[model samples]
Target: MLVAGTTRTAEIEGISAAGADSDLLVHTPSADAEILTYGEPIRAPVVPVSPSGCPTPAVVTRAVRELIGLDVTVVDGGLAEPTGAPTVTVGARPGDDVREQDPVSTAPGVLAAAREFGRAVPDDEVYLAETIPGGTTTAFGVLRALGETPTVSSSLPENPLELKQEVVRDGLTASSLEPGDAAGDPADALRRMGDPVLATITGLLVGLVEGDTAVTLAGGTQLLAAAALARHAGVETTLRLATTSFVAGDESVDLETAARALNVDLTVTDPGFENRDHPAMDAYVAGEAKEGVGMGGALALADAAGVPMEDVRERIVTVYDRLLDGRDPAEPQP
Candidate 1:
């Protein structure tokens, strides 16, 4: 399941300091990521923009769909724009920035929707991914509410830990939630500070476990927050966290440590973008737009399905080039 949502926190100035264009920055958390994951212009009429200038979620998702034939189910936790792809809408309002107010106003309804969606998933094993801007800060807040002192990753070359810490601190204060106060109640923690996507994923994982389905959460610290919530909710089915090597190698956050603390299995996909001859891929090496829309998990699944890493890299570049040049992939290059 590819879960897409938005948190108003991205609108806060300086919250997200890097992206290719200002419009891209705003759209990253909007329906643009979902449109990109669909691998063509839909509902937005243009490719999603990224500061990294190369790899977007669309490229990775398109690669997986073509190479491994993985079916994508998009779930809209809350989107500023509706996706052209069919989606299961769960929330009526976009999440507020926790720093300004309680972010999840309809946590219960969203959770219920997620539970129903999870139960209805026909696949025995599901790969879950997400695209939520300003997610790392929300994840940090949720972690703190759950009594974990976590350092979260970011899309910038330099992870703005201090800024995120300030935002999280403000959020905790505004919500009157002290550290560890919501630790025993994951849902309450989510209500206090998480986005709809986080809450939905938590409920979805629980429901999936109840329905005897295995799940792989494919993202970074945001998914880690979901895993922690799932464990707190007493989910015990097969579960793991998968993300890109950029996140795993990030010095600003200790994802492996956090995963271990939550007792969640963790895996990282090394797509060898560092050796690729593409600016977008190179930007990944430089720590920009490191992971989103389940790129890492999709790559890992493709590799497990016996797709060559080189072929996967080539597909990504091909898709990215097409989007960058605003031309169809089949058109001859000038």
Candidate 2:
């Protein structure tokens, strides 16, 4: 179709109301990013800070879609039925299966669009891509609720058990609930967040794999969570795309843990980043980096896309700095 589903998280820590719509996602959209919403949101991701420590899905989707030249259709994707996104039929239920369009879960409106491109130009391999912010939080919530170990503990994870527990703890705290990390079943997690953008991406993964032309997952932790779900459901796939590889084993976001749960072979290029953001590094160390703002995953996607990493980094950091430090967002940067 035009492109895969384009999703943005709405999370503003201070005022949850801010995330009640796609405002937060639009807050940090890429230079070419567009804003498409139906009306308002109910429960969305909220990032109170201006620089938006996390990369909004709005920004990531716009950038990725621009690079690949795909039309973006924004869906509310709020907890309730969405009215913003284009109507794409996902003629299947949400479960653990590498389903083709013939039978799949949560299909984006664009899949049918992409498939047509394939038919017209069968020679060229075309597929879907996605971006969702604040998804890792949902992942943690899902796994912990499912009673499985979550792997995204630290901004950098070393031990999965500890990491999973930590993520569970944070999620529990954020939701103002008691800490729980008991691995029992997946239904709990799925009921809580399985239907999120993660579900859509997993659907994309299966949708692309069964037919032809590999799919490229364009974000981090959330991709790992989706991959893990695929593995757990016994979906067989070999993510051949470089972007796919980057998500399966990234230490930065518990990709391995997510993959382990999924039981698939989603490999990644090592040391995913060619350059380091000392300032961001300092922020993480200073305990400032928040999940779902989308810096690491955006950087990873930039890497997979072969773009100048600094340009992407500068856009994010500069935009954020100007917005947060009371500088004019319209002012030019040095």
Candidate 3:
């Protein structure tokens, strides 16, 4: 079984008012870290810089490659900054800021493309992951549209509940969509307040199910919304969700409750980064960059494959050290 995946950059990530700094501070380096690690050495990997110093995708991806020996298939759903990795371009326009306008206009086309890709996947089973910035807020919006009031998790330790709620409120108002209005119509809900990744992930799940392939959505709240959309679209396939203990530990949101509500089997991976010596790993314990680039899912898959948890921790720390080698701890460079 191979781990197949997609990547998208949403401009809703750029809205400072949304309280998501996924794209603002580090130039959204997770995209670079994700695919570049599978290719040549990234002479300059994009490292996340925040008050707590967020965890980089390179560590997580490095573990995936070393443990599973599968590379991610990048999909250009939409990007504010094009990833250094080669990508399949399925969308031309980046998502608009949901607070100002409908973020996703190409939902239908993206969904179609995702379904086609899913049908062609050579792997009998795939661990599907995504790298979309600001996806949680869009997840919150989509969940609300689906008649579910969900408190979604965030990369930042101090969850900006008020800011996310504010943005979702403005987005719903701009679209003239009241809560639960689009519950029966997943596409309409996506069109109203979702993003490219949500559409693509939902479509991928549906398509993979059609192909008789078992799929695991590897992320946090965003995957919950995608699974909800799949079920709403009449997909009865039992899908699994894998995320980190950090996300489950987030006091800001109840991911377990949300997953149970959606009828998605949830698995939480404990990488034990808290006991690691690396600062970046320490940041994860502190609640910065809790989950992204399918870190949690990859860990869960590695565990399922019988890779020792200690080995997983060692690889992540080694990668984190190499990526941050010789960099100034005081100044952050893009």
Best by lDDT: 1
Superposed model 1: Cα runs more than 4 Å off: 17-23, 29-37, 52-54, 326-334
How high is the lDDT of residue 174 in model 3?
A: 90
Query: Local distance difference test, per candidate?
Result: 0.74, 0.37, 0.68
lDDT of candidate 3 over 47-105, digit per residue (tens): 54444455455467567677778666666655555456656655524666666556677
Please write out the lDDT profile of model 2 over residues 1-334, one tens digit for every residue: 2122222222323211212234543322222122212111212222222242422333333343334344443322222322223534433222221111111223333233333333333322432333333444456555554455565432222323443345445545543443243223232344333433455545455545555654544344555555555444445665422232333434455555454555534434332223555332233333332233223333455566787645554454543443325433233212
lDDT of 1 by residue, 1-334 (tens): 8777778777666665323454455445444454445565556434554443444565676777777777777777777665677777766357888986668888878887788778777789987888777888888888898887776888777888888888889999999989889876887888888888888888788878777788899888888888888877777554698898888999888777778777788889888877786764777787787788888788789878888888888888776765667553222223
| Residue 64, model 2, lDDT | 36
Q: Which residue runs does candidate 3 get wrong by more than 4 Å?
A: 1-26, 33-45, 329-334
Worst 10 residues of 2 by lDDT: 95-104
Q: Please give each candidate's TM-score.
A: 0.92, 0.50, 0.87
- Sort by lDDT, top down from the best: 1, 3, 2
- Candidate 3 — which pairs collide? none
Is candidate 2 or 3 superior in lDDT?
3
Candidate 2 — number of clashing residue pairs?
Answer: 24
Candidate 2 Cα misplacement greater than 4 A, ranges: 1-76, 79-134, 145-147, 153-189, 192-195, 240-254, 257-306, 311-334
